[model samples]
Target: MTSPDDSLQLTATELRMATFRLARRLRCARAADSMSDAQLAVLADLRMNGRRTISTLAERERVTAPSMTNTINGLEEQGYVTRAVDEDDRRRVQVEITDAGAELVVETIRRRDVLLADMLADLDFTEDELTTLREASVLMRRVTDR
Candidate 1:
């Protein structure tokens, strides 16, 4: 018999795989054709967290500072983001999403939700299964909240 700890590890692995797959599929539903997934991810983070320094965003995104800088450069060129001297600390530059970037994030989320809903409908899952999924989402959020 599998130990309880082994079973727990198996469940965690399955959860991680399922979450990764769903996120990968949703990533295909972006509103901006010019934006790479990483760029949009940083944009969305900005929209959620407000202004942040490149180094901070880099750490949160698990990327090198230069990579984050490149991502921000792309976003800046497209007018999706702007960089300015931090008022509190002029030595540091902060990045914030432009109104256009926020709109893009909203639209992309809308598209992803629609696609996900349609996919779920096609599954024709029982009510209990759908409820379980909804409950699982809440649990997932709880587990991931930082």
Candidate 2:
């Protein structure tokens, strides 16, 4: 029989792999004409965290400042985002999502949810299995919150 420590290690590996695969599958559900992944990430970040400086966004994304600048420029051209000089510091520019950007984020989520729901329906999971997943999801959220 496996020791408690061995069981914990196995459980951790399984959870990691499952979550990674789930994330990839969800990405596949994105709309074909939607913004690229990186652009969408930036938009989502802005929407969730409110407006922030270009430099701050770049740091969070772990990309070069110039690369982030280019991404922001494309988003701006498409009217998905707008940049404005910081009122407190004219030299600093802050980026914010537009109504179109927020709408895109919401729509993308809706599409992914529909896809996931259909996939889950096909699984025909038992009530016990569903309850276990729900509990695991709550645990996952607690882990992420830290």
Candidate 3:
């Protein structure tokens, strides 16, 4: 005796649960490998965008300036990142990933993909389902970009 509105709400909740579970699993797997999710995210950003200022990174990551500073300090200590003064403006500083940082990011990405592939292998998904999932991933990326 449920109404159409109830059915739609249930469907929306189910979708949200599925997304949460998948993201949680992926994050847990990544964490178990000794890399913090925040660090990996920052590394990925640097790889995609090259050098960036600390303020820009803080904004992009939706974190405060001090938090970004601490994160960058940790990465610097691990030799994964370095900061350099702007040649034209000594007051400005830019952060860049080192060779080791790039390598670590690539390795981490491969590991995550392998983990996801293993998980997906057991799912009884058809071709259409797979295609839909791929398209949904693209849309999800667009949503996150905002």
Q: What's the true lDDT of residue 70 in model 1?
A: 91
Worst 10 residues of 3 by lDDT: 26-35
Predicted structure 2: clash tally:
0
> What is the Cα root-mean-square deviation between model 2 and the actual structure?
2.1
Give all TM-scores, in the order shown.
0.92, 0.84, 0.86
Q: On residues 43-77, what C-alpha lDDT tens digit does candidate 2 reach at each position?
A: 98999998999899999998999999999999999
Q: Give the candidate number with the greatest TM-score.
A: 1
Q: Where in model 2 is the C-alpha error above 4 Å?
A: 1-5, 32-34
Which digits, one per residue and each the tens of the lDDT, describe model 3 over residues 1-146? 98999998997798789889987877765422666788888988999899998899999999999999999998899888999998888999999999988988887777778888888888978899989989988977886778
lDDT of 3 at 134: 97
* Candidate 3 clashes between residue pairs 3 or more apart in a chain or in different chains: none
TM match of model 2 to true structure: 0.84
Clash numbers, per candidate: 0, 0, 0
Error of 3 at 27 (Å): 2.1
**Residues 1-146, candidate 1, lDDT per residue (tens digit)?**
99999999999999989989999898889898777888888988999999999999999999999999999988998999999999998999999999999999999999999999999999999999999999999998899876
User: Which one wins on lDDT?
Assistant: 1
RMSD, model 1, all Cα superposed?
Answer: 1.4
